[model samples]
Target: MLLNLNKMNDVKKTFDTINKIVADWDPLGVGETIAEDEYAGYIPEIIQVMKNDQSLFEYLSQILANELGRGFDSTDMKHVEGLKSICDKIIRAYMDI
Candidate 1:
């Protein structure tokens, strides 16, 4: 159990470091944050997550629409899935390092 806590802490530190670099989709150009090429690779899988969970999709859509001034159009559903895939993969990949 103690080891698991330590492992989680390491993951959180990694997440923080990555966030400091990416800074919410804006490249800080410093850390090992998710880049365009990396994001592209994960899109398909993330889309599957969003498709399987309606609440997650709605939450993401609302955030984009209200916070980012990004409105969903005909392509948004597909785009959301892609983005979700990319982000999920990034999160999973970063959890270890």
Candidate 2:
């Protein structure tokens, strides 16, 4: 019972981290809106990855980083790196779960 509770807590924390990353990347919000349709596709994919299997988390993270990088100015390495950092955090949190 205690172990189950701890696992649940970990899942919740992981979800919260994922949510933060998604919100940060929301096209309608502060995030860039370059590839609006493509960006829309990512949320569902993220949720699917969250459900289907954990082994694919790294792939999802890389795809997200690539999509985010494409949305920003090509010369903006700082912004691209920041987005990649967010992806890294999401991947780390997912792994923790």
Best by lDDT: 2
Give the per-residue lDDT of model 1 (tens digit) for 1-97: 9999998897557545444433445422323444534333323433334434454456445545665566655376787675565456445555446
Candidate 2 residue runs with Cα over 4 Å from true position:
30-86, 95-97
Each prediction's whole-model lDDT (CA)? 0.50, 0.56
Candidate 2 collision pairs: none
State the TM-score for model 1: 0.39
Number of the top-ranking candidate, with TM-score as the measure: 2
